[model samples]
Target: MANQLGIYGEQQAAQYFLSRGGIILGRNVRYNCGEIDLIVQMGGEVVFVEVKTRSSWDFGAAESVTPRKFTRMKRAAAAWLEGQPYRSVRFDVWVYVVDKGAVEHYEGIDGGAS
Candidate 1:
């Protein structure tokens, strides 16, 4: 049930971005380091989005990410970029509130400043 809700939030996050003139590049993009929930292209930057969904907002989005997780995201992004041309990238976080069925997007939360 938890996994299903996570996937549902991912789908919601993807659609949310797509509705706002973003192009979906990848979903559940995985590498040895970790997984990126969604990859999107908006304007000139490649955006890596991390989705965190909850049945309730007892713990907020900002409270959920740990330093270790951020490190993994950076490592995974590096792996994903291997062999590809240099592209501007940034990290985004999506907080999905299941009860409301809405997503709160945080653009460029941390890292990937190029």
Candidate 2:
């Protein structure tokens, strides 16, 4: 059930980005450090996205992204960029509320240096 919800949330988030003129570069990118839910390019910048989903906001879905998780995300993003051409990169988070069918995007999420 949790996996299903996560997949659904990712799908919704992908569509949301596409509608807003973002190009999907990759999905479910995994590395020894961690996993990136999605990679997108918009306005000449590459964005590594983390998607968190919940049935309700009672527990604050986005708040689940702790500092440790952020560290892992940054490492994962770095791994993703290792072989790619240099470009501006940033981190983002997409919080999806399943019950509300809504998504909230937070851009330029900082996790210090990768």
TM-score of each: 0.88, 0.92
Q: Which 10-residue window in model 1 sums to the lowest lDDT?
A: 105-114
Find the 10 residues in a row with the least total lDDT in model 2.
Answer: 105-114
**Over the stretch 13-33, how does candidate 2's per-residue lDDT look in tens digits?**
899899999999999999988
Model 2, residue 81: what's the lDDT?
Answer: 90
Number of the predicted model whose TM-score against the real structure is largest? 2
Point out where model 1 deviates above 4 Å: 111-114
Off by over 4 Å in 2: 112-114
The predictions' CA RMSDs to the true structure, in order, are 3.0, 2.7
Kindly report which residue pairs in candidate 1 clash with one another.
none
Backbone clashes for every candidate come to 0, 0
lDDT of 1 by residue, 9-110 (tens): 888988898899999888998887888888888888888888899988775764566767777887888888888674899888888988877667778877
Give each model's whole-structure lDDT: 0.81, 0.86
